[model samples]
Target chain A: MLEYQDYILTEFNIVLLSSIAILIFLIVLLIFEASKIRSKFGMEEEDIEHRLDLLRHLVGAGKAYLFIADKEGAVVDINPDIQSLMGLEPNQLYGKDLGIFTEDTPGSNVESLWQVLRDKKLPFHLQLRGAWKNGEEFMETAEIRPLLAENSIVGFVVSRIGSTDGEGQSAEGSEELEKAYAKEQVIVESIGDGVIVTDAVADIVMMNKAAREILDTQESEIGKSIYEILQLEDENSAMLLPQYHPLAEALEDERRVMSRSYYIVRNDFTRISLAVTASPVIVDDGIVGGVIVFRDITKEKDIDRAKTEFVSLASHQLRTPLTTISWYTELLSGAGSDNLTDEQRNYLDVIYDGNQRMIGLVNALLNVSRLELGTFIIEPEPTKVQDLIMSVLRDVQPSVEEKQHEIAFNSEEEMPEINLDPRLMRMIIQNLLTNAIKYTPDKGKITIDLSRHYPDLILKVSDNGFGIPINQQDRIFTKLFRADNVLSKNTEGTGLGLYIVKSVLDRAGGNIWFESEEGKGTTFYVTIPLEGMKAKSGTKTLS
Target chain B: MMPKILVVEDMEAIRQAITAALAKAGYNVLQAKDGAEGLEIAFLEHPELILVDIIMPEVDGIEMVKRLRDDDWGKTASVMMLTNVEDSDKIVAVQKYHVYDYLVKSNWELDDVVEHIKNKLKAATEENS
Candidate 1:
């Protein structure tokens, strides 16, 4: 068994020796595979080297001065172009502070270029401004950006652009741009209307001669705040201003106010009425400023006033004779002991009614004149709408009874006493109620509703009358517009009631609208803003 | 005695109509053509109620009232303005003189004018009593 064990051991040793040799061979092959893979990686390094060479050639050849700085702002590398631009070699700038180039800038602090990179945060990645060296002015535009890694700034690169353009040198495109700019400047200066340009902070930057004369300002207005030049009109002041008063809205919201009339109380004590427009000057950067244009409209205003005065005078002169005719007709009705034929009585009634219609037309014209002339400045007194409506109803009750109209007045919630011109409120209700009485068929239903429309007092008058023709609806508030359907139905209408109502409401800063369908019914809505009334205190009428 | 109401108007027809209406309505009525004559009639008649016009020839109603308000008879008299002139200053001035009421002549019917006077006179009587 021992000799057999020895032979088995020798065979086992031979097998083990072959296994060791195989392991050694595997080790050498593994080393060979590793070096082969390493050599392939070495080829990739040369590919990176080729890219670096291209970058070096591009940076060296380009006229733009390109430089990179380390985290400490010390120059790591700079292109050869700096030698020609700054008259300094790249070797001299190496290991130097970034502020060395800015030392020649008078009054500029020699500090970290990091300070400049942070201070002049160029919103569009580039900045252009005038730079001087040896008293020669050159337009210097540079782009600087931080090299960011993992959300934190690691390094920075600065590139000075406009490589070929020097002082007194211009490209063909730039020459054309300058020429266009000059033409535009001339056009702005020669504009007929007043033109005033303001910066973003509302400082006056430029004003043409027309603007200076119209605004009663001098060329010294430049650098002054706009509000200092023109004061805002007070809301309660009875100033004749267009709906859009001042340029405040234009500047704040970017709304273009075109041909809006406003008053400018000049230093010379003359109130100049100007129609003005304001538009914002927006560039690629943002809204940088605003441009305002204005023109004097004093002549137009005077002509409008003259027209109103003539209408007022004509109406008053006509009303006197009409009053006499009205009284004579009332007396000549053959009432007491003077019996008349039905024919005579009918003729007298016709004369009286015709005179009354003429009187109504005259009164409406006078009211419109008053509204236009600002004579109807509100003399607000605490008035209960219910009481006013009831009084108006009583005044029109005779007509209502004659027509046999069924009127319903509803006010569920009692409203507080509203501050309003009692006369104006009375006229509004009277016109609406009288029209309802006149237009509706006998025994037709008329409804009135008074309620709070929240921060407003709303009165809605509805009548089951011959509704206005839909085609003529838009012209219902014209000075002498009458709907054809209404004109045919009721020949007595002056067509001035709604116009007078509209003018009165507009002067009071209220709104009037209506909804009507032909042959169905008509509902007129009136809304009075309660904001001014609630806050008003003293009477500021033209005394 | 019945209340003596005076009608002071510049328009002749308006004056006569108002006077006739007031007389028919059972008030003793005195008539005047202008503010000058109205003041004279008001002083002599010492009417309990006076209806005055605003714009007149010799003395305007506002000026006449300003003069009459100093005297005792005019101080106690209940005056109402019946006029075509709708001057806010005149209206406010009349109120300042403690006028009873202001009626726009063109805006009122004859019956409404009479009714308003009767009601106001009745209220004045009630208050005085």
Candidate 2:
């Protein structure tokens, strides 16, 4: 009996000890799991802090002004960029209503900007008047965009500011801009020229007051194409392609183009000679639009016609007298016999020389008239510069020898044959050489140099002569404008030589420039583009 | 015998100078105060050539030419235009009337006008022959 009782007690003790060990193991496992969960939560908190820091830096560095607003549209936080743009510090603007900047804005502009933000649109422009802390008001063009997160509106607004003078001002603040616009309007209205602007698509976008007045159209014609607006006859109108239109051509060629003369009749049944020039408005690397400026040149044309008539009549009338002088001089010389003394012969020679001089002057006058009337047709053929220069040299040789002046001609080896009008070229060179001889002091040196500048042939005439005064340079090429100095020294000059030279050069797409000091000397450079003579054929048709 | 020619001009210096030159050139010259007198004399005497100035009182050179073209005396005699106005429109008008030649006063010498007259007379004689 005593042995049985002891075994039962021991078994109970073993069972109690095993149950306690199991409870201890389960508690240790629970502690390990709880520790792992706490560590994971800590890591998640750290990740969120890092992400927020990155976002804050990004907002601060960005150029577009950034601000955070509560759901009620109260400003929560403002970035430095926004603070500077609004001319306010961060603390001063924090928690202020976002509507503060919009207070002076037009109601429609404010409403539209707000609506765009609320609708979560990408961005929109806002015209607003904003005041600085110093009580100064400014016009501002701003772009407002909403900050979206997780496909829902976040607590932020992003605004970018542009010029404060263009579109942002209230009616009062816009007075300056309005005044400028009015001044431009007045200038455009008062001008006699017609001005038209077209978009890249060649549709009329803007027309100045003169253009509208000239076209004799009402406001209803604003959105029409140029062709429609002008009501041009198909046959008379220039053939314009999408790329060949003056504006478009300017864009493609990167140069301005002048159209041929066209006729425009006014409402009063007055005819006008119209000339058009189209130039492109190039921005950055592309063409945005083009402007066409036109003017009426009828008065100029009439004057030109009158001048042409005078020249034609003058030439014919002068020729008859010249012929008489020539015949009488020949008769007098032929009538010479034993009775003719040396004094008589000398007197006749003086008369003959004076007659020749008059003839030369008349010829120069006729040449000038032809050039001004655009009737001086240059028929270009293969010609040698050397030969042309030599002929000019021969013609002016007598004057050169009479003045005891020396002329030197220098030409490049292998000088390319140039295409030019021999008659015109002769006239040009002869006039220049004659002027040099006439103006130079006795024993002065004159040099004619011909060289090929790539794409052009250059003729330079340098003379140690009575140089043109610097103050009188501008009038040198004006018809009948002899330099004061030249006029004082010489009374026989018609003052038409340089004028004709300039006109001929202009028509041939050539250029002339001279450098002179009153006493030193003068060098005149003439550049004749090789391709320009070819282009002159088109000018001939204008006559 | 020198052929009779009428000189009509507005400028006194030019008219006197022209008369002197023609007389020296051995022509029997008649002088008129203006285009009207010139026209009257032209009809009465039927001079070989009537020298007319363009701008004048009562009748201008162009009007005189137009009247001569319309008259019987005009067909038998020749008319020449002498003027200082050398405009294209004037020339066109002169051409329309088949005036012998248009002369600019500033550009012409006294001898030129005398020679032109002589040429016209010679041509008329040839046509008659």
Candidate 3:
């Protein structure tokens, strides 16, 4: 029985060994075949590279620019056209990060996108904001495709298809290049947002499907001036002046222009609101053309208008009850208090206090709502900041005295009255002062300093109060967000003061920042341009 | 003679509160429940100052003011807009008709309103002199 089992085991081993040998032989054959196929592909890649070199040489004599980057996004080579466009010497950009030539656009992570495409070995088209070495801004559509060899990515060919040096190129060379890029027109057609590409003279060169659909144009709009086809108008349906036209501004200034307040009158005699972004396609340090991207925002405008109306109605309803409560509370506190007991009087006082808090919240809500609605008007006039601050201080003198806080006011001796919205300034000053008075403990020191710093007037407010908690400081400017330290110490804060101040400053092209140390103190710095606030015509003013 | 002021607020509580406060401040105060009654009283009595609410039943404050401006006696009459609607269009509209002051009612207390009226009337009196 043992010999029989041994024979069976030996037979099984021989069978398994033969199977393994055969499998190894097959694997070696497959590897050999793969290498052979790889070599064939390598030869074809060399042929394609030669052809590309020939093509690049041919295109070098034209107006177009060509840029090449390695797999890791380092610039490998750039044609002479690109050299002149970027104002760089020959071979100067080699080994440098290709991102240096690109501007950082909001909401796009170019680094991660490149990493993703490199890993996937995929081709992608991107709307690139290209920057010249001389700090000139331009826009272009860039096609980045992986240079593949033996089924692996080796490098990238970054090609942009647009006439850069407009009139200098041979017509034959440009026509050949245009024909080569005809296939890419499918990509532009597939984009959802409306796109209109124009030439240096603001004449339309290409209009995408979405653009035609949005503009309600059935006939081809090609060769027509973009201004004539777009017919962008203001809110009052008045035709936008040449200076106000975003595309014109982009081409003339060679900078990006964005506007959400533009309306386009369609062939159907209907007007639609548009959120438009126009960027100049600059090349060779010259304004070549512009690319205008627009989207219909009629629905968004409608929704915003409805929300504003709702808030307006709600505020009116809210204020009516608030007014009743406050006025009645006043009457009771003034005359009816003579017949009330001490505890009853205290309850009345509490009611009045609560009502006042509600009123404050309502006022803050109205201001925030107006700001969000874009209905907050800024009407600038020459105003003395010192006098405004003094008046606000006078109003809050009782509160300051009640808190026993020492106040100091300092200013430059020859401070000139600057153009500013007095009412808005008063609101900002009142909020800052009230916050300082309310947050600081008895006998805390508060200081106010006003000084000029060339293009800006700086106003500094410092308070030796319970400073913001370190962890909660980042959220202080967020709407209705109070710091943890302040929340525990004081319940009077509506948490809207800093937010309102920030929003107002942002709209007026001013800035506000703060330095705070937990358990130490807080200082807020505000800067407004000396050139003054631009007057914005809107339906309401911030209360 | 006490300077008369008309209170044309739709809210009874607000009207009575302002009227009582104004009376206490040594002014003869006439009360109206709505803009219609206020206009009738305003035309009949010709108060020195008319405190009108913007949003009211039947005839609104703006319409009332517009009609008031059509009359010679009411054209230059002092009208203080006392309402919760802080609309710029409404304010501009009232300004064209010469609204003496535009006050959002919730922002003022009974005492402050009385004080404001006293100051406004004093100024008008001085202007006349």
Candidate 4:
């Protein structure tokens, strides 16, 4: 029986050896098949490393932070930028749930990402705050997208910082942005001055509200040439243009340019005097566009013309009377009165004196009119100040003597020759002296002081007579304004003498002011620049 | 003998001064206060020349000149318009009346008035001759 048992054992050992060898061979075959399948379908270690390197470089260059989540909403992979963005190490985030990376409730972005993948819709953007491992937070504009496999959703999220994607946020932010853009457009359109913008090729790019009003058109002028838009008036008709258009010239020079008196007619048939300034708009080292600003000055031009006409008329009309007065007075003092008695002769003398006074008054009125019209042409030349003063003294001598007044003329030193218009200078001095004599009481004393106040010629005319009231001093230089004191003292004055004096001084680049107290005295000081200055032609009348 | 002259002006001072100057010049002067009175005198005496002021209360000088122009009896009597307002419109209005001459009051000397009247009378005599 023992021998039979041993034989069974030996048989069992042999069967076990055979089974073990078969199992070992099957295991080696399965290992080879698995490696072949891995080579065919799965990524090799080297290939996977290369793909990860590419992804790192892509995330570094792109403005996006990339991440991957598993089906369980757990973070499986992340780029280097994700670490910097969320302040987390890759190891710390790898096994952690993606909900921990966001301050929002868990599974929100994940659920949306899965929903998009399941629905197979277009990608959508979301704004959320991302939390760092250290508990710091930052705003992220995230585009959560689903990775699809055989039409089933995987997990992926792309986030960028501080991007304006025009997406989900409070309505106020979007509305405010839209309003800012619209307001910019309105401001560009509502300005009164004409604004024209052109591209580098001198093609009209943009035109503002006033530009279209000036150009008299409603159609969009973009892409048209500037010369087509700006139709300049005829050159012979007080309008001019260069060989090239203003915008084209500005573009060529790459600088600002101006055009003088470029007339443009509006749709209402009114002509406008357009002064145009064109400037180049440069960007990125090249000319991108140009802009032109235009202003209308037609009213100013009309006023100028009217002023010239008024001056000529006033000068001729006033001069005619002056000529008559002069000729008749000379005739009366000569042989015409030879047969008259002493009383008759004396009467003639009074008439002659009256005529002379009328001439003086008329002359003063003419000066005031001319000065107000800005047509008083000041032809400045080298003149002796003393000579002008003497002439003024001679002119006012009759009035001075009629009041039985004495005038004291004083000059500390010989005044240097100054440049001034002789006629205008005479008018200024005479008006000042006349004001002094007219406002002074009978037998009053007048003093004329002339001195050099460095770079200026100063003249002071003072009178020991009724002075201007303090309250009315501010308006003494105004046209046709006479102080109450002067009016009470003398009612015949036209009250235009000091106005004429002020205007003449202003034209000569000089200034005049006075100091006075009632019942004391009045003193007027005039300071004039020692230079040749021409009077501006054509002033506007203000009522 | 000096030719007869008439002075017409609205202002008393201006008229008196002109009449005195004309009398001193040795002329037989007929004085009137306004254009209507001057026209009446012109028809009655048929003065050699008449000086009239333009701006007056009754029958302004321009109208007086027009009436005198229409009168056949005073056709030879010369008429002149004198005024202080020298606007172009007024000058044009006076020109329409065929007035012999217009003078601004501030511009006319007594001698100028006398000389102008003398020239007009001398021309009339020359035309008759």
Which candidate number would show the highest TM-score if scored against the true structure? 1
Give the poorly placed runs of model 2, Cα more than 4 Å off.
A1-193, A197-203, A224-271, A275-293, A535-543, B1-129
- List all candidate RMSDs to the true structure: 17.2, 19.3, 18.0, 21.9
Residue B33 lDDT in candidate 3: 86
Per candidate, chain B TM-score? 0.95, 0.91, 0.96, 0.86
Clashing pairs in 4: none
lDDT by residue for model 1 (A23-59), tens: 3454455445545544866646544443344334334
lDDT tens digits, residue span A1-543, model 4: 656444533432343334334434544554555566557778576544433443443344332445666555577777553465356778987877766544444445556654655575344555555664446444555555554444555445444333243333433465787799899778878889988788777788778988887777896598887776776674335333544667777888887888665787667777777788989999987898888888777787678657756754675456445545555554566555677788877876777767666655665565565554443456577889898899888878888889999999998586778887776677678778887898888999999999887777889999988998999989999877888877766776667677877777776788999899988889999988876545443322111
The DockQ-based CAPRI class assigned to model 3 is medium
By TM-score, the candidates rank as 1, 3, 2, 4
Span of 10 residues, lowest total lDDT, candidate 4 chain B: B83-92
Q: Candidate 3's residue-wise lDDT over A1-543, tens digit each?
A: 656544533432344334334434544564456546557666455545543553443234232225667767788767554566467886677898777656545766677668768777776666656555656555666666776666677666666544333322333467777777886798888889999999888899999999999999876588898878988998767899876799988888888999898998888888899999999998899887889999999999999888867866687799989988988878887875789888988998899889889888888888888887777899999999999989998999998888888999999998998999999989999988898888888899999999999899999999999888888878889998987777777888788899999999998989998898876788989899999987888988888
Tens-digit lDDT track of model 1 for B1-129: 899988888888788887877887889999888888988999998988889888788898998888889888788778888877665666788889988487876667677888999999999889999
Q: What is the per-residue lDDT of model 4 for residues B1-129, given as tens digits with 9 covering 90 to 100? A: 788888888777567666766787688999888888988999998887788877787898878887888899765567777666554456667677666477766655667766776677788889989
Question: Taking the candidates in order, what DockQ does each have?
Answer: 0.19, 0.06, 0.69, 0.05
The alpha-carbon lDDT assigned to residue B82 of candidate 3 equals 93
Fnat of candidates, each listed: 0.14, 0.00, 0.89, 0.03
Distance from true location, Cα of A49 in model 2, Å: 16
lDDT of 2 by residue, A267-384 (tens): 6666566677888877896777777788766787788789786876777567555645654664565434356788988887888778867776776777666665655566778888
